[model samples]
Target: MFSAPQHAVAVACLTSVIAVAPVPMRSAFAQSQFTDVSSNWAQPFIDTLAQKNIISGFPDGSFRPDQPVTRAQFAAIVRQAFKSPATRLSRPFKDVSYAYWASPAIDYAYTTGFLSGYTNGSFQPDQEIPKVQALVAIASGLKIQPVGSVDSTLLRFYDAAQIPNYAKPGVAAATQRNIPVNYPNAATLNPNQQATRADIAAYIYQALVSQGRLAPIGSNFPASQYIVQGGSLPATPSEAGTGTLAVGTELPVQLEGAEPGANLVMTVGENVETTFVVAEDVVNTRQQVVIPEGSKIVGRFQPFEVNKTLGTQFTASKLMIGNTPYTVNASSVPIAARKKSSLSIADLTGSITTLAASAALDSAISGNVRFGSLVPGIIQTGQTIGKQVIGKSDTSDEVILVEPDLMGLKLNADFEFLPGSTTAFVDPNSANLYQVDSGTKVDLAAQTDNARYVMVPGETVPVELKTGRSIYNRQNEVLVPEGSLIRGQIVPMTVNGKEGAQFVANEIVIGTQTYPITAASAGISPSSLQSLSPADFQGNVIASPEASQSLRGVSSTGEQQSGGLLGLGSLIGGSGSGKKVILFNPTSVQMEFRAPLSLNNFNN
Candidate 1:
């Protein structure tokens, strides 16, 4: 696999004839010429290759470290790095014509087993190659063989599920040969990310070192250690440095000096920044210290849309533990108004009674009913209505406020720490600190009766979790407890000529933390007979002889009316009868959780 420096020089000379004029060709003497690569992690590898004439920089004296490396550019590098004779006959690729700039390099790479065209008989030479694909190609070209189990070796650098099927063998072989060079974090091998020009330089140089063609650099860089023989996997960022806290790591904190009714006002569509100190030392299941006590957690309330009915919803967007910024996918937290009040059933009944009494007086003046009898009946109906209203309004009259104090709020997700000496790298996959399964059940009580009045679409109402019940996972661990607050929105629906609202749960608030939850079941207890109708009022008014004759006259004419003026009185003047519409909350309500909730690292 090793090639003499003179061989690279010769290859560079040949390829320069067809090289792009914009990128100036560098001579073997012009090493470390790229200005942009001075501080790059791949600088050492780039300098070494440039000195050997195996790589060159652009005319502007820049390496363009992060620029993607196309397949054609990779082929040119392969031709200059490997001097072995072709083992197989070369065939023209459909996409690479004889006039193509890199056609010669492509043919040489294919015949020497460094690369292969796709099954479609086309070589997409201009396409950017993925990191794993580039690693596999270099390993194959150098005939590297795995010294250990392929599965186990690849798992050391990446999650098993992340390894692609086609690149498995090649990646395994590369790992054993110690030819893979990962910058930033050694443990994270971003297999599918596009390979950069800097990345290619590191891979080629490492391949050369593995074959004993180049001496390994005595550097403490993470990538350098992987190339040294028998070097222990570079210490995880945690062990080697001060340790970095991964994004999505939950930081449980307490409100330093907050009172029960403290108000935190946040406007919709604006960012609110705040800071809280860590309440306790947070450690993961791996015993890694993610955050230490007194550590500062910086956070900002992201811009959000306020639902006129649901109040203002705020979600945490920018969060930083120490100096590392995290992408937070947390649930929107609803802020409560400073002062709120609810209507009582007694109050509602009183208003209805006053209206009914006035209607009754009007009926008597219009000669619609006997004055003396109807007046006595109206008085009795009012007394009966008061008793029924009392039974329906058995709920607490307390107003609830939503105020989450972050000072002592425990983290709802795991906090993973991987510290480095100066800069820390976070594991992208580990950012999802909490996992909630599907089909979990949660029981809730309606805060306001959706059936109290005709509900309109887009209306938001409050609900609470019923007492004495807890939401549990399959392991019987409680996720949410009774008395938690939930917000529901009304979705208007009409069926069989009956119109009502379908309550959809938009969020659940536990303590100060809020999570989005879907409601699977919503039901309300049926109203009592007395609440549904003014039966006593109808009995007294319709049983009189005069009322009986009026009913018979309508009945004899085939109009089929009943209860005489009593039915008309109930329809026109009764507070509790005549097409009664129960639109808001019922006497009792139950709501079930539609999504699974996990409290893996949740603390009470």
Candidate 2:
């Protein structure tokens, strides 16, 4: 492990040849100078040392550039250069063969704490010096400590993982100190294998110069121009440091904010950057995200909540069915709340691109659905009861569903908001309006409180209203037509008076169309209905004709009252539908109201 640095020390000892050779043969010295070395790629330190005759090639005339250095040889060279007193030898290892030439060198290195033998007592002097181990020894020998923290986060070398674990800490210390040129490609740091003679020479020479004991090594060299002045490792690399993947890749908006995810940002160039989220990890290799070099990408997400225990439901207050509008009132309309159900995202917005709703919701909800009710509305059956009353009832006073304010559901998605897609509703929370097909309707009856109302761009709550009264069946029993009851989120309501009283749901929000609940066929359970007086049913339970027959067995005298069901058609008046009405009121009207008027007067 320590032989490579010892070889460097040996090369340093060879420095004596520089002074003696120049005097003996100027021709030989010039021939051996830095310019004479044909390895044009050699760094400045190697060039300087070659000129000094401190390191040389074999008689075969080929400098085995990849060969490993040995301990005894290195020890001899270091002794020559430093001229330090030798320490007393102690036979620490059992395997030191009687004729082993490195015994003395190994003894010196061990005594000085520059190297240590294996625990088994063998000094494998012939072993190649691993890159990391070599770096540690060099730092130890030179007593160098680079500035800044040893941030593995800054390393982007291709061979980062190849660095031996034992040498990492020392190498990191050396890197910060700027003593060793550990990486040549900026992309690779081959920690193990062999330490070439040229590499060893370069390291030793630089250490000498950094210590102010030797002159600067590479002064007048062509390659010197490419050296980044005052170059330092980055605090955060543009890519994922060390690993195979080139990081800082961006993804599309597959989910809304209510998702669980992480965003990673890296610096590509000075101020040039990109971002990615952990959500992209699922399809990373195949689905590579490509973005412009300088553009910033964001991860949009949508997440879902899964309950391991039991299923649940929630009721949302505001619901949009296509273009129609609907409201969930505790007094009038009721909604189902669900606990756990698979979620699929049909759309997404406000991100770099688009992502799948399932992907988004996975992390968006994760372990906690406390905030899940923000986007979906679902409720349990038999959860609400509609009260039956007689006279016109006021629904103004009642507390409906209670929910927490959620920021948004987060997902692993790529989504970008189209310009002007966000709009504000009566509630100040701005909602992202979705242009979906009008015919589609989704039944979300198994979501939790966190999913009741979704916090879209403009919508603040997690629970959004669904079309019609959200009916919930607790025992798996089908409540045919009349049996399908509408229970208010707050007070219970039922049909009253001769003809069943007209019940209007707060909203009928389908996929993209939203209409008011006005059809006479729509009825509420006397217990589930809100605001209606019990007497309003007049013995007639509002139900489909088929349901009426099935209820004959359970019919009460109140529901069988005959004449009590007449003249009830006018209760809701004519076409109690969703009417868009605009009014202009003036204290004084000087002219009659006219349609399609063309004003001829010009502005004064």
TM-score of each: 0.34, 0.31
RMSD of each: 30.2, 34.5
What tens digits encode model 2's per-residue C-alpha lDDT throughout 339-395?
222221221111111122122332343223323443432211111112111112212
- Tens digits of per-residue lDDT for model 1 on 393-493? 11222212223443223322212222222122233236433434433444445343221222222222232333235665566755676667665443333
lDDT: which candidate is best? Answer: 1
- Lowest lDDT sum, 10 consecutive residues, model 1, at 385-394
lDDT of each: 0.48, 0.31
Q: List ranges where model 1 is wrong by over 4 Å.
A: 1-31, 220-604
- Per-model tally of clashing residue pairs: 21, 148
